[model samples]
Target chain A: MTLPLLQVRDLKVHFQVRAGGIFFANYLPLKAVDGLSFDLAAGETLGIVGESGCGKSTLGRAILQLLPATSGSVAWLGKDLTALDRAELKAHRRHMQIVFQDPLASLDPRMTAGDIIAEPLRNYETGLSSAAIKARVREMMEQVGLLPSMVNRYPHEFSGGQCQRIGIARAMILKPKLVVCDEPVSALDVSIRAQVINLLMDFQRALNISMLFISHDLSVVRHISRRVMVLYLGKVMELADRDAIYGAPRHPYTQALISAVPIPDPEKERAKPRVLVAGDLPSPLDPPSGCVFRTRCPKATNICALTVPVLESAGVGHEVACHHWRD
Target chain B: MSASVLDLKNLSVRFATPEGEVAAVSELSLSVGKGECLGIVGESGSGKSQTFLAAMGLLARNGRAVGEAIFGGINLAAADENTLNRLRGNKLAMIFQDPMTSLTPHMKVGHQLTEVLVRHRNLKFPAARDRAIAMLRRVQISEPERRFEMYPHELSGGLRQRVMIAMALMCGPELIIADEPTTALDVTVQAQILDLIRRAKEELGTAVILITHDLGVVAGMADRVGVMYAGRIVELGEVHQIFNAPQHPYTKGLLACTPRLDDATASALVTIPGQPPDLQQLPTGCAYHPRCGNVMERCRAAAPPLMSTGGGGLKACFLENFGSVQAGTVVP
Candidate 1:
């Protein structure tokens, strides 16, 4: 049997946050990502959707080994990535890459767009001549729909959407096998956001690249991902195929979140009954015990607070981590 | 029919940047009826925000406005500083995207709200305090009395935004301009804030100008919608007409590009090719022709005027059958 392209198990990321008053300073572990496990096929897309403090971004970084995981196993092509040394991981870094949310901030201001795209090529392949690198950069820029003549322009000269295209070129110049897109289109304008989304989809199909897409927008995530995972307070609330997750979500939090999204159709918006979850999301620093989502879950019982529900399959290809999830 | 609460004619705003003079808004005209909500939707730098900012006399230092904004028998665009100071916040109120920046950090929420009432209504301290607390309770802020003493930083984001809304409505303004009021909020909190704004319109009968990029929010709140592109109103109509039968190609393309929640298994999202036009160096004729799918030879040579569709709407396009219900093709 063939191995999955990437496999993660029991992934946990914690940060030591300062707690208590100044006079009695003590450290508390902020469980950013308590436990997450998933697998990515060779050319599949897995989208992670959640709100601000849900740790979606942290999970993406942990997968790339950019941040050390407190405890987990990241198996890439049957090799354990978490156990690899610094030099060994550096050699494998070419196969993994990341695209940040803010295009201008992630890019170096001093370097021209062409130089920035070519920097990865030069760093990975030392034997390549300068002329070859320049040719490759120009080719990649053209593929991403950027004018080859505008390569010499600085990041400051381009608009937000154009800067995002340049960011895509930089990430794809090496032709990596996996790309972690962290809110790639959130910072762009509405019209320009569509352009970037289409461009990313085209690249994924043409190159057969696997992406771990992380975003807060549900519609955008559903548009690109084959499977989706909903996160709340750094725990997986539900995981299933895109259609299953959107059409028939099991967890109450997922139901409320999906209903909270205002649809563009006026007639339907007026007719549909809205499920509004009350109160703000509790701080991750002091997450509620047992089921982390119990504080906001409408169907919470006494048992929900007494026991932590484990992620289990509710139906074929659908897994929900709630004790009171009734189909 | 009653006269419009506010009328704008031939409004233009220009900014002097290092590159050159950029026309942020050009000869735009709009109006808000009594107890109506007008939503202005556009991408970044499309001048949706600048149009209202000019009417409110809130343009930046390097920006200049030339227009006639008749509000309550007075030209707000031509009003003096003293007149504007008296009218602003008393008759005309504005809500910003970030509530924290608008509210003073050092002052208590109660004091900030009371200052508006004291200055506008000439109310005593005790009376103004009572009014401020009442407004807070009206906006559905729980523990209104206790929250009244809390500083701006002490409140959560949703509470801070509610406080901002309460502060804006303290003097019972006739017109309130909310610019992306819910953009910085989460989905659930965004719903709550929109509900508050709707209640304000229904109960208080105040006209509102809502500026945002989210079509979903516009569909829920706006009675009328205006689509802007390259510093011009490409299309304007009732919210139902704009959503069901968009006229301008730019408006249609924008609708198609957005991923709709109702589209359960949509395989691909439509996209408008090419970049948004730069205001400083906009192409001649129809500004959207370069990226428009239904572009023709005439569109590249001559500009199209805002022609009335005679259905309580307007469209600026060369196509004769612009407002047809069928979706237009997207030219690559």
Candidate 2:
């Protein structure tokens, strides 16, 4: 079988945060990403679904090597990225790019849209003429549904949607094989969200790019992803094909998440059974023993509290990390 | 329909900017019956929040509100500061999107909760504290006694929102205006918050005005919905009618554009072309005409008034039989 374009094996990102007052302050390892393993085939979209503080964003950054992983490996094109030095990692960055959540904040306020998009080309292709870069930037502007005339406009001059287009243009200008989209459309208006999603999908199709789509919105994830991974407090609760994860979620966390999404249709929304899991997400610094999700999980037993549940094969291409998933 | 707890009659809000006067809300008219939830859905700068802000007399320095927002026979638009101050915490309450910013950071959460009761309900500090803690428990906040002493920063986002709800519920206000209450929250936490709001309406018979951009939240919580665009209500109808048989092109486009959890066909999400109109310089005629799929010459020439749709719905569209023409074409 052909090697996957991106392979993440037992990836963990732990941060040392200080606890207590200044005098008696002690450090604690915040397990943002404990252990996550996944493989992305060429041009495949792997959607990571989770709530805030679930470490989905940390996993995305760790994979991109933007944030250094505490341990484990992220292999891109059969080459280990963790071992790469700064200069070596920079050489491989052109093949991978990230689209941030906040559109306006991500773009440099001082830089014009044209300059922002052209910076990538200027960095990689030092020999390219200024005119050539301008022409390519303009082309990308049109591709991302931005007006070519607005290339000279500052990020503030553009609306939220237009600013996001500029951000997309900048990311896709490198023709990256893999893109880590971290809640790309969360900041956009509802009417503008679809436009951005469509633009990403089109680019993914035309360029045959693998995408690590990270979002808390399950509906948007279900739309874009072929495979889905559900995360809770830095651990994978379930991972499977989009249909299997959404249609027949085995893990109780996945089931609750799916049920929590309010359907737009009033009739169907009222009819659907709600699995409202009680309480907020537990702190990752001091996570519960054994299964991390047992505090809020409905099916928690003595065994769940005593021993951690490893991801086991539930069905073809499906893995669940729950002791009582079968029940 | 039951008696309206809050009635807005031809309300309009305008802000004087350096560039020009921006019409934030234009001649909007709607009413929320006692114990009923009315949702106002719109994109940014669509004046959904401003509509309620105008009613609450909470407009900024340069902003001016016209027409009448009658709440319990008091014209809120014309109400004096002293009169409004008396009515605000006692009869009317507002829950903002960000509880962190909305709530006073320096004060204890319990003080914030008790302040409403002490000022409006004329309860002593000890008695108000008791009621505040009880309200916290009622909203399903665990360890209510311990949580009461904690400051806002000590609480999580969901807990802060729950505290906001508890504060709103302290005086048993007649109307609760929740503007994007669950926008900052995660989906799982959002469900719990929405459920709490639902309970307040059902149990206390409190009129609720849920203002949000999320149609999914509106579908579950709102009894009726008002689709706002370019500072005007494009469509206003029952949640079922609005979803099942949308009469306006804008409503149809919005419903189509939003991604659905149930729909997993791997098809492209339909998008409404063009950006939302600038409030300062709105397009001639229908503000949505520039992006409308079925735009006609008349739509560009003159705006259509919000007319009744025979099925107890109001639509501001000139198109005849929109549901029939757009049938079997929308992505399910």
Candidate 3:
């Protein structure tokens, strides 16, 4: 009976790259987001997994309209975000927020933590008093496990994990319904990475915030997401529940990815047969036609090259873009 | 014993700063056996790299190396450039984290590989070229002869890394120290590289000192594991002993932090609080005391020496033995 929190239909984000800089003027479109579609339910976390340059990050930014959407529509709640004016998009910014991959770059060094959290609320709510804004900043910090004393501290004073917490506080300050978390813990040390992961989970549960968590780390994705979508060369390779995806991944690439994760067990390491993916990922600019993964897919057949495979159910609630599935 | 290819006994590495001497590696003793792959597992600033650098005589000009370093029965701790040069590369070599920086961009890939052989082994052009191309194939790079002509820029990240390994392994060194060799590589490439390193070690019977943060890689690659934290070897033992039952708190925390392939969800990552202590301003007692949850009264004032646990692995924690096989602190 309830509508999906976010709906994306045939989203395609392509960049026109001039062959020899701007002077050559030869326009060649880079297929960064070649036909991609997935839905995020309210309070549900959808994990996007892929290697770098797979357009996973681009997909997140495109959904936020942080970058220009070359084609397709992204409807959030009831509003068609793709059709909104610049002013209207800014008005809706508070509802859909993003936590960036790099905490250092995302946060301003000149501004204190309190000011960074207050900036979002002030832009959205003009009638609020200064004292009320400070009170709310303190409240958000406490909600995210930060002491009230840390409010006035500079970004540099905080560790990578703490700076990330500040980033979280800023994202949650406005009470956004949906948040796009882009590799939130990649920069952190392993010990600190876990703490930040826990913090994010606690914040998500408290707010019931829907999120599009994009990361190269599969383990992190498996922990946070209910539904997992595997991306390869700017296209969705497989989509299913997290358990089905991590437990019994149908795609060969997903299987390879799952196997590649180093388990800290000596016996497991020696016993496991590593699925080695030979050769480099194909450049997005010259992505192979038909199935995007055909170049690297071990199961690639003639049908895989002749036509594109649509997202069809290979199993119950499991959609895979491969003709090779179930064969 | 193979006479212990390389040994760093009571080795201490420090950098002279405007403030004072900051000890990066303190009273550390380590040795690699011939053909044995000893993994140095630690978070950053664990003095993993510093120990190898101090042993290999590769410390920067500003850095100082102290204590005993006997490689091939030769004292290298006090060796001059000429003395170190007499043994560098041909007998002992190292591969670093970044591959692109290791190989010269101006030279062709083959030229770079051949130059190392020529410089270290004093081989002629023709002999070096043939051996270099052979080394390329040994590292599993396809079209070795053709890739030989290609410049570093033309190759991929994986290829550049392979070239770095090939260069290091060419002269049949008795010991190879790889500092996070595959950190920059992708998972598939990382696995390939790991397999390649193992094969190379088996073929050459060369001892390998591998330093890495990824426990999975360490588990898969290492025969013996040494966990370094705050410039000390907090835990050291056979791979099975360390993985099955990590005695040190730092080691246990690291294993828990790794996202398990079988963990139900990806979100429940274990987090150790605070950062590694500033090397110069470390706690008086245990370096890990501040972040330690099982902090004992003695741990607050007196640093626990690296003591052998009742079990197979050695530990430096005051608690003696603790921690379950739980994946992490909490399950989400």
lDDT of model 3 at residue B218?
85
State the local distance difference test value for candidate 1. 0.88
- Model 3 chain B: which ten-residue window has the lowest total lDDT? B323-332
Q: List TM-scores for all candidates, in order.
A: 0.96, 0.98, 0.95
Residue-wise lDDT of candidate 2 within A64-134, one digit each (tens)? 99899999999988999999998999899999999999999999999999999999999998999999998
lDDT for B111 (candidate 2): 93
Judged by whole-model lDDT over C-alpha atoms, candidate 2 comes out at 0.93
Candidate 2 TM-score to native: 0.98
Q: Cα lDDT for residue A263, model 1?
A: 80
Best by lDDT: 2
Instruction: Flag the better candidate by TM-score, 1 or 3.
Output: 1
The DockQ-derived docking category for candidate 2 is: medium
lDDT of 1 by residue, A102-154 (tens): 98998899999999899889889889998899899999999888899998999
Quote the positional error of residue B238 for candidate 2 in Å.
Answer: 1.0
Task: Score each candidate by Cα lDDT.
Answer: 0.88, 0.93, 0.85
Off by over 4 Å in 3: A21-23, B265-270, B321-332
